[model samples]
Target: MDVVMRIEQTLDGALSEAEGAGAPPGLAAAMRHAVFPGGARIRPRLCLAVARACGAEDFSAAAATAASIELLHCASLVHDDLPCFDDAPVRRGKPSVHRAFGEPLAVLAGDALIVLAFETLARHAAACPERLATLLLCVGRSVGMPFGIVAGQAWESEPRVDLARYHRAKTGALFAAATVGGAAAAGVESAPWRCLGEKIGEAFQVADDIRDVAGDPDELGKPVGRDAALGRMSAARELGIDGALDRLDLLIGEAAESIPRCPGAAELRALIRLEAQRFLPKELVRVAA
Candidate 1:
């Protein structure tokens, strides 16, 4: 199967497992709703890409990690779109989870999906315990306190916050998890690879900042201009569009350079380079230049 199909099948199977057994009646459906019609599946694809670059013998473990990362991502979105946060009316071109399922159910659905992420990883741990543990830690750190998505959300309420810190937690954390977790799953333990993850993560956030300012709602599948409208700090706001784009290019180059000295590194570098185009309109690219 193709990359998209392979990712969809893997995620679908995991969602099915999450739906089965003793889950509350509507909970499974709600969780499924949050995940399907997945956006780009970039994080999971990154996970798989890193795994491949690391010479993984079996893709199953990395696939599981990818699915788990996607689940956590879905859960984060469900929460982020709630009235408490972005209060977004639509996601992936559909009604937000809270709008479709009601607030309480939406909250439960997000919670359930998070649990499912950990469970999915646990099920695959037997084959690669150390890697599994590393992935779990990386994901948990990226989703939980201090420097995770949760911290990202918390930053919105703080009286003072750093733009870099907020972007790293809110956006870069997961990208970091995706790359590092993928490497761990492939049994590759190298500091340079880990640095590559961080660089890519930062670049991903810069790209997102650009998208929030210049991307169309139809293209982004969510509200644009919300960041500036809310007075949220962003790279575009701090550095101007051209400056932010330059920063993104620099970070992407850093990410590409950090790839290990190995046979497949060139392909991995190419993938990292493509990430610079995310949510960037062709016209905007010209205007920003």
Candidate 2:
């Protein structure tokens, strides 16, 4: 199957599983609402990309890993748009889960999706049981305490914040999971892939910060200027837009340098360059203009 098709199939199946066995109909619907019409599906795409770069032969396992990463990302977005956080009422160019389904259903939907992510991984363990532990570890560490997306959200409530740590946890953790988990799914040493994910994650955070400051909501398909309004730490706020852009460029360079010596290193680097272009709001705006 094509990459996009595989991902969509896995996601659809996983969501269906959540709706089974007397699951609440409204909650299931809200979960489906949060996941479908996904924006870019970048984390899963990166996961699959890294899996292929690492020469994944277990395509099923790789697909499961990629889909799980995307689920976690979608779950994060559902929670992030709750009334308590960044609550502007739109997501993926549509009413957010909370806005459309009510906050309680939205919460249930997010929780269900988080559980579903792990379930997807466990269900696919038969494809490559040996790597299952590592995959679970990667996913767990990316969403749990101390240094996951949970920690990233927790940072917002702190009296003082470490911006690098904040960004790493908030955005970079899952990217790290994608790269590392992808390699592990392929039965490769995940260590070499870690820095690439870290760099890419950080670069993404910088790009997102830039977009939050300067992007059009219509173009971005979501509200902009959120970081400032929420009084959150932002690369654009601290470094200035030009500096943040420069930093994003630098991070992509470093991410390219971090790619392991694999069969498709050169091609992967080229792909990274192409993905990097997608992150630049200025360039995107200029083209749109």
Candidate 3:
């Protein structure tokens, strides 16, 4: 199967396992809502891509790893859109989980998805027991932590914050997990893949900062101008739009260069360039000298 098809199938299967089970119908439905109609699916795609670039022989384990990363991502989005966080009304051009269901259910749904992510990975662990521990560590550290999305969110509550660290944990952790987990799932050394993931994650964060300042909400499928409204630190806010744009381009270039030598290195580089072109603001690209 193709990457997209495999990803969607694995995701659907994972979520379906919850439906009409002993769980409450409403909770099950809410979990489905948060997962379906996913956005770019970039994290999972990158996971599978890295696995392939490393010549993953166990396709099932790789697919599970991809699905697990995507589920954590979806759970994060569900929580991020809550009243306590971004509190946005729309996500992926539709009402957020809290808006569609209630906040209580939304919270449960996110929590359930987090658990489900681990469960999905566990089911495929036997395929490569030697590497399962590494995969679990990568995913766990990305979700929790002194250096994970949870820490990233907590930083907002602190009086002082390290912008780069905050951005990396908040947004970059999972990206790192995706790449690292992909390699680890294939029983390959993952350290070489770390730089690529971190750079890509940072570039994606900067692009998000730019979009929040100047992007159209309709085009973005979510509210824009949130950084300033929330008084959050952002590249666009701290560095100015033009400067952030420059930083984004720099990160994207760095990300491409950071790819480790692999069988499909050229193809992966091209994919990164294509995604950059697709995601980067055309206005920013046009304005750069």
lDDT of candidate 1 over 1-289, digit per residue (tens): 4667878988888888876789777878888899998998988999888888888888878888888888999999999999988898999989999999899999999998899889888887888776777778878987999899999989989999887788788888888888888888888773456678778778777777788888888877788898888777788888999999888878877778888776578899887776567646666553222
C-alpha RMSD between model 1 and the true structure: 2.2
Ranking 1 against 3 by lDDT, winner: 3
Model 1 reaches what TM-score against the true structure?
Answer: 0.93
Candidate 3 C-alpha lDDT tens digits along 122-224: 9888878777778888999998999988899899889889888899999999999988988888778898888899999998998888888888888788988
Question: After superposing candidate 1, which stretches have Cα over 4 Å from the reference?
Answer: 285-289
List the lowest-lDDT window of 10 residues for candidate 1. 280-289
After the best TM-score superposition of candidate 1, give how far the Cα of residue 157 lies from its true spot, in angstroms: 2.0
Instruction: Identify the superior model by TM-score, candidate 1 or candidate 2.
Output: 2
Model 2: lDDT to the true structure: 0.88
RMSD to the true structure for each prediction, in A, is: 2.2, 2.3, 1.8
After TM-score superposition, the amount by which residue 147's alpha carbon in candidate 2 deviates from its true location, in angstroms, is 0.7
Error at 101, model 3, angstroms: 0.8
Candidate 2 per-residue lDDT, tens place, 1-289, comes to 6888889999999998988989778998899999998888888888898888888876888899999999999999999999998786889899999999999998888898899999999999997788888899999999889899999999988898987898899999999999999899989889788899999999898889899988888988898888787777788999998898778778888999999999878888988888887876745422210
lDDT agreement with native, every candidate: 0.83, 0.88, 0.88
RMSD of 2: 2.3
